[model samples]
Target: MTSIAKQIERSYSATRASAKASRLVAYGIQPASRMVDALDTHSVHWRQWQMDVVETPLLEHFPEGQRDALVYLSADSDTTITQLEPGKIYIVGAIVDRNRHKGLCQRIATEHGIPTAKLPIGEHLHMLSRKVLTTNHGDGWR
Candidate 1:
């Protein structure tokens, strides 16, 4: 993942933690400034600078496995349905067989006593990024 993607992921995790703790930490990637005039900008933007000096280095210290463990690969319903595994992270991508209600991939994981976190891809794209590649193009172009 690119630095931006990693930052976005970590930002989401941090905000989620802050929310659960009932504290308004306001930690995340700040939106780009919209002001047109560069000279009009007042006050030094210390967050990015401070982050580069302090926070960026801390990210490198986290174990590789921990980072990978935090990543959840979202896939289409059919893809998820077949690839359900214990101790693995995943998110719902697209619903393949809505009529059969096969989209509930979490149920399969639960039955096996595996911890699974399911995020609705359409609604929670920011939180869960889909990375699964498929041979079948949804629109039948293939």
Candidate 2:
């Protein structure tokens, strides 16, 4: 991840960690004590997750043959997602730049040759603010 404003970075990290915790609880799994302990510190809460937390880039994590399974979710994408397909790995960039970095996720997806799609928010509900959704909000949609 590129260096962003410290405050935004912290907010993003906290949001992601909280989302992960929420997901674990939602699935009837108790979040580890280590994650709860880290909540009071500056560290992110990633230990409770049962899945492997790979510290590698997406390109390196997935082989070239499996690249087609990656689908990037971006608000700037022309295509809007109607339904998620099985076997596809949907990626939501956990970026909260307050509009300072518009289209950054889409650009990165393009660079990586990953297909992009936006949520069909406009077709479902009208909103006063931009259609961009927070990480937790996006997860709730699932």
Candidate 3:
């Protein structure tokens, strides 16, 4: 998952982050203000997105009791996603850290009691490179 952390956000240049957010929006993904302030800053074509600016963090945006429905996708997670189940709000982090902060997302998810899962890439294909994927690539948008 590429969810934003101050460190991760700082790791990216503002323009690159904005461009990534734009791509997510292009793929119909709703971005949070904490990750990218494109809507508030009016830095991009805000009208092209089909979502309202989410001012709060995801955990607060949803009802407390619905926390179980939130799933954080982290490459470090032990669990692998075999299928896309309905009624689950899957969170894909938006940062590109280059592995400097390995297991950060999974740690965050564990601390918040949110379940975490890695993609089933290993089950389908073998690769010579690290398993980490870019936010857009992981989401099947690139």
Indicate which candidate wins on lDDT: 2
Rank order by lDDT, top first?
A: 2, 3, 1
lDDT of 2 by residue, 2-119 (tens): 2222332343445455633321111111244332344324335434534344445566676666788888889899999898887777775645535798889999888878999998
Q: Mind giving the per-residue lDDT tens digits that candidate 1 earns over 1-142?
A: 1322333334334434452321211222224422212212432342332122222221243334354432233343222333345544333222232336443544543443433443334442343334333222122222
* Ten-residue stretch with the least lDDT total in model 3: 20-29
Ranking by TM-score: 2, 3, 1
| Model 2 TM-score relative to the real fold | 0.63
Least well predicted 10-residue stretch by lDDT in candidate 1: 21-30
- What C-alpha lDDT do the candidate models reach, one value each? 0.33, 0.59, 0.58
Cα distance off (Å), candidate 2, residue 118: 0.8
lDDT of 3 by residue, 47-126 (tens): 44443445456666765577877788888888988987776777766545356877788888888788999888766657
Model 1, which residues run further than 4 Å from truth?
1-97, 120-142
Candidate RMSDs in order: 14.5, 8.1, 7.9
Cα lDDT over the full model 1? 0.33
What TM-score, to 2 decimals, does candidate 1 have? Answer: 0.21
- Candidate 3 to truth, TM: 0.62
